[model samples]
Target: MESSAPPSPELRLDNLRSLKVLGKGGMGTVFLVHDALADPSARSPFALKVLDKSSINSHHTNLDADRRARWEIQVLARLCHPFLPSLLGTVESDQLLGWAVPYCPGGDLHVLLHRQVDRVFSPPVIRFYLAEILCALDHLHSIGIAYRDLKPENVLIQQSGHVTLTDFDLSHKLKPKSIRTAISSAPAQDNFPETRSKNRRNLTRWFPAASENKKGLKKAKSARVSPVSRRKLSFSNGEKSNSFVGTEEYVAPEVVRGDGHEFAVDWWALGILAYEMLYGTTPFKGSNRKETFRNVLLKTPEFIGKRTVLTDLIERLLEKDPTKRLGYVRGACEIREHEFFRGVRWDLLTEVVRPPFIPPREDGGDLTASGKDIADYLCSLKSPPPFPASPSSEYQRNVSYGEF
Candidate 1:
């Protein structure tokens, strides 16, 4: 937690210029913006999430929207990691509240995946992306935060082509039971003795990560990915969330059951994500939401071919029971050492200068030319900002869990 984005002078909506809408989601609009005064030539630009004050407060329940906006800003202000966004500045006006972070020009993982020949990533590429994502999630967890949202859309690619996570409005701060509890919750240490014996060779017969037979991961171009939600779901031990939240396709079984959940929900979502990346579709996605939840709770993920290390990793991660999930007991430390990443040098992730994709440079060439006032432009939108009643925030809608 140190400041990485160069500090910007105080900014006001009046002085900012909106160049493009990066995305539209349940919370607000993310834009590519520049400070007209700070970067007069607009040589440097950032991503800004703007929320309309009036629209956010329209319905009583919209208070949740307001709280999440502020919460995201607070989280960004406190983060300083290569795979995480750092707050550049903020704007609070009578009509709007906005904050800025580094603009990731390389687009999102979803867009990158579609750019691939089979709309999926190879095993090695998946490993590269997941490793960075794992680090980002681990960093957030280190500070007691549970990231309920873990989808490709939230994974942004920097100009350098490396990934960084965005949209923290759905994240929750958690409290572990105790130092002793954190250390003692090893998933299978008693049964798996690879760390201390020659049995390591046989471990893969029992567990492995993912494998690839599709076209190799290829270079991709920049594209935008919108934000989504996830529930922290644990109401017990002061360490779980009872709230039902998250994209239906990636929601965990406990979340569907409304049973208390904790950090394990994220690992479940990771399983869903890995499955999608490997096969180009989610495992539990049925014709409808009810069917999907039923599949999540009852159906096993169908594999296309013989099991590989990658498939094994997904299997362990996708365990329907959160308590039995691979990462449940030890968090990311457990997953990082899976057979798929046996020889990886984790420390040098950020040092890689080139990745599978690199975004085209902007350098104010188009920025200075666009002078649309951000505040006025946002105020002119025919639709309102993300409020409690907006169609965009589907996670907030009443879910018929009984249908499953």
Candidate 2:
């Protein structure tokens, strides 16, 4: 599903223009950019994720954060799949680290889900999207990479409306080793149930899939889920992580318990994603972070309507025990064989003439629109303020495209 290829040396920061800010996070910013040079100018606009070396050096988990940023670039460098991203180029300076990849104009599944009737997709739509997502995850696993984060927000739609998984910062490399270590990722405040729900409330929250305009549902600022760490991580062939990571609602029971987890956690999150796609909200949501963890550990997903293959799929995925979860034993191989995906032409997903949803062209799709200098934004983040100006600030990808 993927091949490791070196990035081109010709693509660099100076020739690239940051047209607009696509998204932002604690680690970096994603910008919609196009190459000013003739070669890149021929292609459409792509995304650049810039990480400030200054920012990476300031965090308590600075080592972990730096590793993740580099690892994500490394992951992109090797990826060559229709449902995944490929490295356009990379940049590294004394103060900045960045990389570029194709930009998906269709936004993310979170926004797409909200645009649907009653804020949920039809079964056919869900199946189409899920199939593509599953393929993306399967490809990642095949390369010994586990996609620990599998929320709707991370599923971005291409211009063709097919899905591609983003945000590899939380992804883990799989190693078939049984050895266990005492290593834990990050602090307990971001993972444990003992963390007060009040302070935890503001962090990347599990928003109920609902429209803020529909019923006065209050939509808070979007939060980015943190990563959980473990000394040894693997899946299918028997590898596990003791680290607690993932969104509150989507976190698997094993992860919550700090028990060893692996590729099964991705399946559990997939079940949650499918559930949200079917129903308007996730099945295990609670009033607070503590309650959410409790529900993940103890709650059974409540399903409406009569039994069906789809519901069955979600149930099997939501199994409290990771070992019992669908796709646990065989990875995505088993899940693809399930009845819900019966008749799906898994191999031809990318070749399908018309995907369920194709994004219409917009003004932002134009590559040459005069944009602000990337250096202006890059320099602004070189030195962070004494405190964060706001939870949500804009940023983009960075670095020099040298030999991979």
Top candidate, metric lDDT: 1
lDDT of 1 at 15: 81
152-229: candidate 1 lDDT, tens digit per residue: 778888876778898898887778534312321112212322343332222122222333334232322222121223
Off by more than 4 A, model 2: 1-10, 39-43, 55-62, 176-237, 363-369, 380-404
Measured on C-alpha atoms, candidate 1 has an lDDT of: 0.70
Candidate 1 versus truth, CA RMSD in Å, comes to 11.1
Candidate 2 lDDT, tens digit per residue, 1-404?
13445754536667778776776776677777777774444257778887766655456667666787888887877776778887888877777677888888777787766655466765556667777787777767766777888998888877766788988887777763233221211112223334343433210121112121233323222232224554444444556667667888888888887767777788899999998887768878888999989989888887765666677889999999877888766677788778767666553444453455667655554545555557667775444332122112111211111100
Full-model lDDT for every candidate:
0.70, 0.67
Q: For each candidate, what TM-score against the reference?
A: 0.79, 0.77
The weakest ten consecutive residues by lDDT in model 1 span 390-399
* RMSD per model, one decimal: 11.1, 13.6
What does the lDDT read for residue 329 in candidate 1?
Answer: 71
In candidate 1, position 186 carries an lDDT of 18
Candidate number achieving the greatest TM-score relative to the actual structure = 1
